[model samples]
Target: MQPLLSSYSSSSSLTIFLVSLLLVGDHGGARIILPANVTVPAVIAFGDSIMDQGANNNLNTLAKANFAPYGKDSVAGIPTGRFSNNRTPADMLVEQMGIKEFMPAYLDPSLDDKELLTGVSFASAGSGFDPQTPNLLGVLSFADQLDQFKEYIEKLKGIVGEERTQYILTNSLFLVVAGSNDLANTYFTIGIRKLQYDIPSYSNLMVSSASNFIKDIYKLGARRIVVFNAPPVGCLPLQRTLSGNEHRMCAEKHNKAAQLYNNKLQAELKHLHNTLAESKIVNIDIYKPLLAIMKNPKQYGLEVVDRGCCGTGNIEVAILCNRLLPTCLDASKYLFWDSFHPTEKGYNILMNEVVGRHASDWF
Candidate 1:
């Protein structure tokens, strides 16, 4: 096979062309091959909608996308509770790692032993590091997800036995993506955390919670972990609609809060990386890449950035984005699928940049 890197050019034209190729069919996008020495047994994901892959389908939460218009572009044209138009960052990450085409949800009833041996997502759509975030939405909390992960370990042991389970646990790549909801929902939108703590203090609280979660997973045998920082929460279509004023510009305050939390989270990860034994913990910044895409959609072969592809694109998400509402003609041209999540094309572009820049850090 030709080297994937050889196709990459300094200009944005090739990237845009590649994105167009990705949109041609379901799961027909370019494949990402890692270095020869790198060995990732599986790819496990945990966190909010960005990483969720049908984990919310079984749950009775309004934060679900398992309906029409959600998976209109997927292989079977059926929604799988993923927040995007098709596959999410979780699916893309695993695919990029050459593990599988899709990442199954841990709660999927139809999940088989083969999927379990590979990997599955335990992430909940509305979850955050903050406990109150998930509680407010009636979705799985971080603690609940952790418990499910423990259960998954036992099942893995049953399928592959102790030795292989341990090997998979230690060798697999674990993705922790969250914090956008905590700042976007809990702190600003709901104003629940604001009463107790200001931006600085609230950010500290979030970072502390995230650190604890990482440590907990580390204790559970996660050796190579990638913790994604909060994206620019203010730039999301929902935030722009709610807080961006009449012009619907990016909310600077929310962006600042995310930046603050990201800074602290990066520092905490560094500390954990140095202190933890045989652990590879690194923080990948999704903030800048997404923000850049939003700022210059044209550079990415995207046209609409201020709104989503669903409904009016101003504020629709999850249940609000339904069959009743109409979506954009071409989701690949839009940066967001709903108000809060990126389209599959958007995710593909972002993942390409992320993996290209940070894949080496895992080793």
Candidate 2:
């Protein structure tokens, strides 16, 4: 698919293709979907806050959402350690796929019959590829998330037998969203910045860890993978608020580092797709679409661009994202829900871009 896009030297042809495809689809009653042979039976999310939902319940860290006003609009209006007030992309993905609700987070002890069989989230807020990054934020590290996954697998084997568990692995959706915390604490914060490895070296380390994690999932029976490239972290509200210079410029140095990481990740996924012939790995370009909105929020009729609706919107994210600080009167006008996340509307736009890739229509 990327090769076909490359044929059109300039991106103009790519836009032409989008238009042509839509025109043709409108003419026909049926639209092209994901490959007909594709099958997604369960969803297994691993990584960070972007996909976490109360998974950190068992962790002793400050990163938790099992409280209130979090997931407030969602099932029971209960905080689910999701770092948000409602369902996240991980949950949303499973819903779109027509799967049962996202598997329960690996932590919740109340785990019973239904939740255990559906799917689960191993994601943790503040979790990152680099182990040290989570320290500053006091959240689960990425490696810990994997340990959680292992436990889930072990339990599933108990419930559904090892042979059937293997079948579950080969047919589930493994979705990942991480790296922002690494960029924020490791590079943006002055302390971690002091011993910073060069951008290239850091990116290599990230790619290596992430790729290995993907391979581990493949070995465990995950055949369909939807991998998300890190978003343009430097452009996020948290960064903008912390920049302190008043100009909402993204930390370019950090963004470049993230870009280098994404570039490598793309190549690695292509390689993985080839090597794991029995599975399908999809790379969802989260950075590009969000960047488009960041650069031109007015195009989307978004007014509050640099700051989040949560009060001052400066450097206040996660547990700090609240009205105890300066908050916007109407959050809908803002792009970010908290300093680090998106409003429901913002998520809707992101979903449009991401879901298309999962569909057969695009990638």
Candidate 3:
């Protein structure tokens, strides 16, 4: 399949046409067809708000997004705790894999046995590889999420026989998206980690934690894994509003920190891929593609790049972006739903490229 974005240009008419095409259905762009060699029976996810489906809804944390204007564009037209205006990347990934239309959150009480077999997201909105990141926000830590995965495994074994459960686990596509919160929130915005370690050392800590998480899951039976690198956190609307100059340019320092972590993470994943037995661990580069769209929004048929579609688009996110505030008339024109998360259309664009370019590597 060809890439969604094969070239970049500034033609207004072309941008308008592409934007129209992107807003066609629940998710835009051409559908992804898996290769004959691949067999993704399930698509499991773990990480922060980027991959969070609704795991934060019941948590007593400000990271929740189960209210208003959050799911205005959803099929049901009600908030589902996703950080986006509609479906999240987790949901999109499952759909792209042809396993299911939506991936349920592991914490959602309504999940049935069928959904469990398809896969679920254990991600919390404010979570990071850093244990303290979720502790500070009262959301599920990586350890807590891992514990939830263990519980899920037991439940799956109860539903299906041990052999089938193992088959499902071994064939499922495991997506690990994290480290953004560690750099953007814990280290830079919160400034707590700065007191402990500088950029390189903290990157090491994140890499080590991520490595352990991968190994832990590998031991549990996961073989086909995709580890997403940190996005350009500096370009996020929240970062720009906080650290950008009067013009609110992308925060170069924050981007640098994210790049540092991504480089370390790529190297670590490479090492793990070589060492792990019968494992296919690949690092997906979210930073470059996202930065490309941010640098030239029109290339992706998006208008607002520096800000988001909700409220002032500068600092509002999670609880701050609520029903009381008016959202943009057309969120499809915007790249972000809130200060910290992408809109459904933006995620579709990104996922289209991701599944097209890298989905085959897992096999």
Q: How do the predictions measure up, each by TM-score?
A: 0.91, 0.83, 0.92
Among the numbered candidates, top lDDT falls to 1
**Looking at model 3, which ten-residue stretch has the lowest summed lDDT?**
16-25
Candidate 1 pairs with clashing backbones: none
lDDT of 3 by residue, 1-363 (tens): 012123324463243221111000127555557777767788889888877888888877667789998999998889998888998888877776677888889999899999999999998877888877777678888899899999999999999979999999999989898888888878887777898899999999999999999999999999988999988887887777667776778889988998999999999999999999999999999888888888788988899987889988876677767899899999999998888888999998888877778876877
Q: Give candidate 3 regions above 4 Å deviation.
A: 1-26
Q: What C-alpha lDDT, on a 0 to 100 scale, does residue 17 get in candidate 1?
A: 22
lDDT of 1 by residue, 38-64 (tens): 677888888888878888888766778
Each model's total of backbone clashes: 0, 12, 0
Residue 98, candidate 3: C-alpha displacement in angstroms: 1.1
Ordered by lDDT, highest first, the candidates read 1, 3, 2
Q: Itemize residue pairs with steric clashes in candidate 3.
A: none
lDDT of each: 0.83, 0.65, 0.82
Better of 1 and 2 by lDDT: 1
> What is the TM-score (0 to 1) of candidate 2?
0.83
